[model samples]
Target chain A: MIRMSNISWRFLSVWRRNLIVYRKIWKVNFLVPLLEPAFYILAFGLGFQGLVQGLSYGGKALAYTQFMAPALIAISIMYNSFFETTYASFVRMYYQKTFDGMMTTPLSLEEIILAEIVWGATKATAAAAVMTLVLGLFGFVNFPQGLLIVPLAFLGGLAFGAVGMFFTGITPSIDMFNLPIFLFITPMFLFSGTFFPVSGLPEWAQTAALIFPLYHLVELSRACCLGLVETNPLLSLGYLIVFTLCFLVLGLTTMRRRLIK
Target chain B: MDQQPTAAGEIILQVDNLGKHYNGVSAVAGISFAVRAGECFGLLGPNGAGKTSAIRMIYGFAPPSSGSLRVFSLDVADDWRRIRSRVGVCQQDNTLDPDLSVLQNLLIFAGYFQIPADQARERAEELLHFFALEKKREAKVGELSGGLARRLTLARALINDPELIILDEPTTGLDPQSRHLLWEKLHALRARGKTFILTTHYMEEAAQLCDRLVIMDHGRILIEGAPTGLIEAHVGSSIIEVSGADQELVDFLAERKVEFDRMADRLVIYNKGNAEIEQAVRAGFHSRQCTFRSATLEDVFLRLTGRELRE
Candidate 1:
């Protein structure tokens, strides 16, 4: 087995390098995601509340803004993870050939993949945290949960980041990236209970939505932020954990083959 | 029964009958060579000659279909990571991160080798200075000229002080002055006892930089020796070029029982010296220009690999 400390150090170094590249355009980094969650809160949470009526869970009516706040946070994490891993990672892989540069060292393919996932997760979690504060400022999110959202956001990020990387491994060009974002990610964001509950959908649609890990992420984030931890939180957590492991393995293996072969 | 000396130096790398096939066509046929410590070995080949494939095998980037390869006493199959840590590679295409400044690129690569941040910064600065790129340290790699980018690539390869440096056509697209600068830098590094394995198509580059080299063609070794030795063995001492001359010299040389090859507009008289051939040309044919010079590695390459342009 390789040394753990070496792997961790390499991962942190790669993470720092990625941050340096991102810091070059910090305005775009902060402003883009900031506008996203705010737009979602104003347009969907406030505008659609009058049309869709209240959401009743356990015979109690939850405010539309509060019910959707955690889901919006989950969506932001997923979007950030997907954006960071897909476009940014693809640029590094194909255009920059940065992985080729790194592989010349002692760093293994596993270390590179893990480092990428960690960076994506960090970016996603930071965006989620900032959006969470924005929600609090607008009096939309009222969770007293002490930083649980951070780890959940991280998990959400890991799931999407791994999945995004999996797509990137198979994508031959930057234009092909649209297939995953439009066909899979956009549908998940719209129908995976991000802005509304999935219960009202058709049985087949609900079943298909259940297949997406984002549905579980939305459910888990909502449960944590609303102080309503269910007895079966493990189910959603288990789904995300399995999704993360599978995509991480697939992404890492495919990328290794693509690079080393 | 035969025996060869096995104690010249430790065989740091060995490839026995290595081959790589793409789509059932061999890019690199069964070939074998070994590199010893402190030797600047070269693979001299034209484009599409499979030098890249061979280097890829040595670095464990691609597994050879049929070979027993070893690096630093470790099997390539089992110890690639260990081997990679001790080796550095500069590919034909520049691999610097374009968005990062020159210094940032070096620091990031040093980080990949798990160097401490402080040491990485210091080494990056030193490498910048070594390449005469200290002034451009803060410039983004995208802004550097081709020569400067290549220098940065070389400097980055030396970040970890690798024991084995592999360069694939490292000076292919540089200006003459840039090429000379790179050669000087490489020579200085070689003086410090760093073993380098480079592949280049330029005959002068091979002659100037390589201590020993293998001429490769169609994925196979055509000849291997020191540059001057190869020229001496294949091309003889001197070649006389007579341009603007016709078949009269050829006929005269034939009458004198002289050996030569006739081209469309010139006759290449291969011999020990220009005395006999110049006499023949002066006595038989009225030529516009006649020049005699010592044979070069280019002639040796042409003789071994033929004059056909390799696509």
Candidate 2:
């Protein structure tokens, strides 16, 4: 059972701590999201546009770049939050002993862990905002409607970050993180319809893709970017919300077990 | 600094029958102690003797398996947040934020206690000066030397201006110069009436800083008293070490009912104001390896904990 008293506004202190560090090398941090989408757009847009012809997505025929542009944003959302909580948080917890230091203060383990998730989501939101602006230059994102993807990024970030943090809690060492990144993350990155539409895959494969959280996030991003969605927006939103809450509780529980022993 | 006043001789920490277990293996086996305000108490023990476990429990870093712990008269289980706000902990590990500048480390830590930005900055500056870290304020923690980083950690712990400070082996790996500097700072703080709970295997540190201490081994308290008192009570005022000891000297001491530790190659005779014993051992035995020295806390620790190697 989660003790509600263990959580408080004090978590912002941890968030602020992360922000100060991020701001130190922010130019380097922002470079990835800003240029990553362009790299993918150039690679796919120029290489595949001629051979692939018009692609059908969300019941609308479109250019190859249009179909993959929103997926790039969704992919960035997943990577930013996932990597932040998994590798970065692991270093701080295991190698740096930052969490152990904070535990001696007024902050509880719940607060520190909660701040990690929130900060991960904040990073995703920031990266998504940068990607959205970069993708807009390519005429892939619609104005005003596309801004909603910022909030969607945060939701997706929570889902991914919470799951990543859960992996961190159970992981014995920093080197062991390669297992989840290889098995769990790589699979999702491929089968989540980030590169191509899921409908093109085998019937069983398409059904399996529905279980991947990244697929739902891609669907929501497409809805915001192109005004078209293959699945109901509410269904995608609800799936992300449920996934985030479940993994968040699991992350906090496992972390408490790992650190509070 | 004295805005939050404290009354001396009042109980600041009360640990009763505290026990901790890992996978059913006990780390702390039901020990109890109390610390009054304005006194430095020491927990002296070797590795795996549960000093860290007990320290963790006192700072509310870990929950005790059994018994009650009250800090500042508040139950740790019920009011850990409140208790933590008033307690400063300098962990055994270097937990400084390496990504931050030396000053940012202190400022950010103060934020954890919900200290106002202005107040935190003021206290941070004061601590930087007090710990002699003002010169490196803008330097990243990664750039600081081990001694400087440790000093920064101690400064960070004081950012909240806590009433009680808990230091776990604060000077384990420092050079003699650094250790002496830290001890000097600790002494200065003690003079200001700050309460501290320190854990260290360095008997000299305990002897110099602790008003009272408990020597622990194998998850049990073997003795508790002031450093000088423990030495006086257990090992007396002096010790005579006779290396290359033989059965003849052992027989001589055994005949007199003199307490001594017979080891594989040497005999340690606990001298309680006995100059004749030293004289006889040197002259009567013709042992060239005999040496006489004042008894210290180390003698008491080795005698109580034994010379057996502990993993």
Best by TM-score: 2
- Runs of candidate 1 with Cα error greater than 4 angstroms are A1-9, A57-59, A228-231, B1-9, B248-264, B272-274
Best by DockQ: 2
What is candidate 2's TM-score against the reference?
A: 0.98
Error of 1 at B293 (Å): 2.0
| lDDT (0 to 1) per candidate | 0.81, 0.91
TM-score of every candidate:
0.92, 0.98
Error of 2 at A106 (Å): 0.6
Give the Cα error of residue A130 in candidate 1, in Å.
1.1
lDDT of 2 at A20: 92
Error of 1 at A158 (Å): 1.4
B1-311, model 2: which lDDT tens digit per residue? 33356699999999898999999999999998999999999998889999999999998888899988898888898889888888899999999988889989888998998888999999998998899988999998888888998999899888888889999999988999999999999999988889999999898889999999999887788888988888999999989888898888889898988899989898889968688887788788764588889999998999988889888
Task: Provide the lDDT at B45 for model 1.
Answer: 78
- Please list the residue runs of candidate 2 whose C-alpha ends up more than 4 Å from where it truly belongs after superposition: B1-4
Tens-digit per-residue lDDT, A157-244, candidate 1: 9999999888887888899999998899989889987766777679898788888888888888777667653225788899999999
TM-score value, chain A, candidate 1? 0.90
